[model samples]
Target: MSASSTRPSYAAVLRMPYATRTFTAALAARLSYGMVSLAVMLAVSRATDSYTAAGVVVALFGAASVFLSPLRAALVDRHGPRRALLPMASLYAGLLGALAAVSWRPGAPVPVLAVVAVAAGACTPPIGATMRAVWGELITDRRLLQRAYSLDGVAEELLFVSGPLLVGLMTGFAPPAAAVAVSALLVGLGTTAFVASPAVKGVAVHVARAGARTRLGRGLVQPVVVAAGVGLSLGAVDLLVLAFAEQRHHGENAVAWVLAALSAGSAVGGLLNGAVDWRMSARLRLPLLAVGLALALGVAGLAPGLVTLSAAVAVAGLFVAPALTTSYLLADESAPPGGRVRAGTWVNTAVNAGSSAGAAAVGLLVGRLPLAVCFAASGAVALVAALVSWHGEASPDVRTGEAAELVR
Candidate 1:
């Protein structure tokens, strides 16, 4: 491949004939992934007047998705995206609608809401993982894949940032149920178009026996574990930033600015990472980025003032997307033949599970311990992830042709 073809720009990635429709639908579906839990929490709290109830509902939703994502991906791998996605999306939307109706009632039972939340989460189409798998299948150039993943990560960040704001706006103007209702609509529309898209339709399904035979190999699990550590560090960093700002008597505006700095750094870093042509293997890059993230976060924890803290956050943020991108690349390479979708889902599950754990642990300790200690803990978690990645072996070598045949 020529340099231009190998190191494609983000614009070039989008210019691919199938790119626009697939990405747009994927984005629509993805925005709901970020929005639903928060919207449900807010809406439930409003109806029941209990933050505790809201927490339980949200937790159920997250826990269900985390556990069920791999199964959903496996179905997609076996049946193709359209067959898997359409039914899943319909069920997910119906569940969300049911939850919205329940939440709107004045005396909605928490237990009933919890069950609905689980159902909604369990049915969430593994759209993000499926999209990545689609890209992997379509774009064979490794360098181009790097750019595509980077772009995906950056777009995800934007979605997360916007999702909450959208929820807050809708809730403020109308009722909390409006937010959940809107999310349901988005999921329905996005998944419909996504499955209908030509690129997604062209994806080949792999028929594998349903059993332990389908599990991710050890090679794929290691990078996923590393990705989890990154997620843990992220969760801690989020809470720590808020606590640190509050301790400094800085207002919400200050907190926003500091958080924005972190996001800005990640966005810029992802774009730059994609533009480069790296000779390093994903196996090697994963640990290096983890270590870099740990060191930067550790220093950030010890910073003396807001300016210093902001700078450290930006530096630490620089490693975030690169580490995540490396994790995806490693998963793609390490996945067993015919198991790419499940491999990506496992990575997603690990990251989300780790983040939830980190946030809960930090939330408990934030009031009792020093804020700097929590930051140090985040770094420590990341360091442990790096160690795990370093000690782990790469996937057994499989010929490119053989792997493609397996998928076909």
Candidate 2:
């Protein structure tokens, strides 16, 4: 049988020794991230009775987390997951609990709430980066590692989707503060289990600390740039899709369906991308995928109505996960030996910053530009990033090493 005809690689990823246990713990802990933002926002609003106050507090929290992510990841890389993750998670969870307690009662001071939330976010464990580094340590085959990253990305996508749902369910009967508390508990338990995993123990002992001491080099630029572009495009598309729906006389709820189609398409694309073992290098494939996403999103703005827009959006979504998964792989390969966590954190931070900037930029443009022009502008962001990456030739060593064959 052909290699393509073999059993699914995803199952093989799970079956790797201690992979299942370690991964589940990471996911459980990571799910807290998905829950915390929504939970905190609702809780703070309830406490302060002002949406403005809540938004500011949430923004401060997010800014702290995003800006400090590299530093947190570096700690994990330098001291290993056990030494680094445990203290961070513990402190983060404690702050979450404290925030929940303060938010439980109405009329809490806004400044107090913001201070605690920022502290919590700053202490947020570098769980996602650490987990990716673990995947690197356990999976030796580059193909298998790609599959692992793909699977991890898809699972995380779902977690974010479900996290809010989980919180919403809790808020249906319990207070929003209760959900925040639950998030705290989840991270605490999950991190404890994660550190206890044999794989992490082994990783702590064998992984080189030398890479952690050195700075991440220029090899990370393309992946970070492309990832930021992907984020910008996706964020703008969310608003653009809504604007398109509004113009077409579609109800607000209809936009959700279109967005859901995008999500489904991304999930499917991530899986298929992982299943393939391509011959082209990731460095080459990275820009092409970004371009593919750009083109699909550009077509989306021209759709006649909701149906056509949904289809176009779905097509755009198909490239989302694949592009990000490829970027993460590039980050991993380009990172110093033990600095994979820190490198991945940089890519993650860029994606987030880009998303925020994209949303703000679109909010401004929606009032000024034609919707089609706005859509094209969004796509152009990714196209520009692709052009930059395409022209920026890799060093000879990188071209032959981490940027090895990943596409046709």
By lDDT, the best candidate is: 2
- Displacement of residue 356 (Cα, Å) in model 1 is 0.4
Clashing pairs in 2: 280-406, 280-407, 281-406
Q: Candidate 2, after superposition: displacement of residue 381 in Å?
A: 0.6
State the TM-score for model 2.
Answer: 0.94
What are the RMSD figures for all models against the true structure? 3.3, 3.8
Index of the highest-TM-score prediction:
2
lDDT for each residue of candidate 1 in 1-408, tens digit (9 for 90 to 100): 122464477877777668878999999999997788789998899888899999988998999999899889888877788888899999999999999988986678889999999999999999998888877766777788889899998898778878988998887788787789889989999999998988887774432333224546556756787889989998888788889988888887787788888888888888888888889767777888889989999899899999999999999989888888878877877665357788888888888998999998899989898877788889889999888767664324322222222222
**Alpha-carbon lDDT, every model:** 0.82, 0.87
lDDT of 2: 0.87
Listed per model in order, the count of residue pairs whose N, CA or C atoms clash below 3 Å is: 0, 3
**Candidate 2 residue-wise lDDT, 138-226, digit = tens:** 87788888999999999988888789889999999988999999999999999999989998887775544554456676678889999
Error of 1 at 270 (Å): 1.3
